[model samples]
Target: MRSLHPLVVTPETAEVVELPAGGAFTLLADANHTGGALGANRLRVGPGRDGAKPHYHGLSTELFYVVDGAMEFLLGDRVETVAAGGLVVVPPRLPHAFGAVSGTGADLLAVLTPGVERFGYFRRLARVQHGLEPFDGLRSEQDRYDVHFVDAERWSSLRGGR
Candidate 1:
């Protein structure tokens, strides 16, 4: 059995990465910090910002807790609106995407179970968005991050191309 240890991450100790799309992710706790149990992050997005494109995790369940404002989610084949104080739990292999409402920004707490070290992935994403790297590079890392992107034209249609 593994020995128990306490992990504490204060705001000053946490690492924050700013994405090119006017959004940010603050790493709260990761697999290494939590004994491979889970990884957590705080996501903040500007109005109309896309938090994530349609994707599915092959080995981890993702959970989102809305802290403030509204979030529009495309879960599976349906589009749902999740408001502040709401929660959405996505099981592994379920297609999902999310964005802040057109007129309102959003703050969310996201958690992934049986965590995969993803800080590097997020950092690479930022680099791509900022033109420091090619987007194609991310394709090769899909399996490493456990995030597989998918087409979501139906979801876009549901949002009326918002």
Candidate 2:
């Protein structure tokens, strides 16, 4: 059996940040700490707010667990509405997105197996390492860190076959 660490993380070590679409998220275990083992995150979306844009990983599997509030998942032609304590799995290369349906935003826990290299993506959006600044500023600094924007063509390819 695998041994469990008494304390792998603590409140002081948790990384928190505000995301796009007026949502906020916290990073429990990130790439730097996990050595790319996997990425785990907690997200809180306000009422009537959508989650991340419809996108898919080139080679990564992701899971989302709804901790509170009501959320709607959109995967291809199918739509699943889930409440607290529900889970959603998204396969790699499958376009999927979600949003809050209830008046109150939803609290979610997201996990990516084998790590999604999402840290690089979030870092590009954040610009500064310490805190999140303006999006325009982040866009300017993206290429400096070798982060490139995903154009519509590339995004479309991923969105297809959903």
Best candidate, TM-score-wise?
Answer: 1
User: How does each model score on lDDT?
Assistant: 0.87, 0.65
RMSD of 2: 6.4
Candidate 2 lDDT over 46-116, as tens digits, reads: 78566654556655678999999988776654667899999999886676677787566899999886564
Could you give candidate 1's per-residue lDDT for residues 1-162 as a string of tens digits? 221898888999999999755688898987777777888999998888778878999999999999999999999988889999999999999999998988898999999998888888888877876789997898899999898999899777755554
Clashing pairs in 1: none
Assess every candidate by TM-score: 0.92, 0.69
Candidate 2 is scored at a TM of: 0.69
Quote the positional error of residue 89 for candidate 2 in Å.
Answer: 0.8
The Cα error of candidate 2 at residue 113, in Å, is: 1.0
